[model samples]
Target: MRARILSVKVGHVTGLREQKKQATRAALGAAALRLAWERGPENVRVDDIAEAAGVSTRTYNNYFSSREQAIVAAVIADRESRVAAAVVGRDADVGLGEAVIDAVAGQYEDEGGRDALLMITGSPALRACYIDTVAAIEDPLAEAIVERCPGVDTLTAQVLSAGVGAAVKVALRQWLRPTSMPGFVMVSGSVTDLLRTALTPLRPALEAAGDTEVSRCRL
Candidate 1:
């Protein structure tokens, strides 16, 4: 009982630390975005961001290594709230693929909308930062899939998630470039179509095989 009490105390301490960290990160991110919006990405400096966030420039450095990272933190914050709360049991009917589509569409629709799309197509800094963010998005989707699909096994879930993540990134990259369709429809159709076209028959077949394997194990 004493050991259990100790463990609980440790867990509480850890949670407090995480909460503080998240608060700091959010403040810094807000400062960066405010500065970026006011002066554009190029004019914003780390000191300006630190001042706006009410943190020391050193604290800003500790949270984000660069001005670009500050921008990224802002981008992620804007996107995260919109990401469908479909991680595992939050919405059992929502498959990871569909959930991902919903989440990404939200990002594409926000402040990083059509105009940001055009800017990203040309801006080297935005491009580099987006590439990094895509990888981060991919990892979480992978874990979410494993959590959502019981008996899916780790390796298989990881591989499937990776393929889905890659497809989403590719579609996002394409959509980020063109304004071909009537506003939002362009990306929605393009991304879903791209994934469907690329993985059509192969994906279904693999899924069936996986199901059979799982069933056999159960038997």
Candidate 2:
């Protein structure tokens, strides 16, 4: 589990084996996403994902309980890559406004990043599963928020976390839908305009939040 691994990294030794396991798990996830794309998530199978990843079905079982978990893994992996990139660019010198601008704008610039949005938008079951994942993230998210924003209540943290999660996702969903022409350019403009209006009060913080560098705990 992510929680256990974090605890271990705090004290327990990290080993090559653990690293390999993580790599294999990631491969399995990529495989699952590929299958989901090829044939809707509902039709995708655990064995198919495992075979695509070139790992055994048993290994797949060890890592994920079902195809949905693998979809979750793919979503999580994309987020990890984005956050890792964001942290690299983040600094105390950057104003919250610019950060927010960057975060919101990055959604438009990253053409490759639309896959998750497309997957969620295209599949009803995956969308529901993603909602469940959002619900489950409260505990860990609140813990992280407490560390960053001292004096916050865990309950409030959870609510804030889930609200933000829902907002970002809804924003993406609206953007992805064809109410507008073309893909991201229109989507980007609309989301930017909507977000700009919605978070006008905390524009700077929102801009800072907009930076793709923090967490996809939302989308």
The number of the candidate with the highest TM-score is 1
Clashes of each: 0, 9
Candidate 1 per-residue C-alpha lDDT over 89-145 given as tens digits, one digit per residue, 9 for 90 to 100: 345444445455454444544444555544444555765676566555555655555
TM agreement with the true structure for every prediction: 0.72, 0.55
Q: Model 2 clash pairs?
A: 86-213, 99-207, 99-208, 100-207, 100-208, 101-207, 103-210, 103-211, 104-210
Model 2 residue 199 CA deviation in Å: 4.7
Question: Residue by residue across 102-137, what tens digits does model 2's lDDT show?
Answer: 543453343335677566656556555654553443
Top-scoring candidate (lDDT):
1
**After best superposition, candidate 2 residue 149: deviation in angstroms?**
9.7
User: Which ranges of candidate 1 are over 4 A from the true structure?
Assistant: 78-84, 87-107, 111-122, 177-210, 213-219
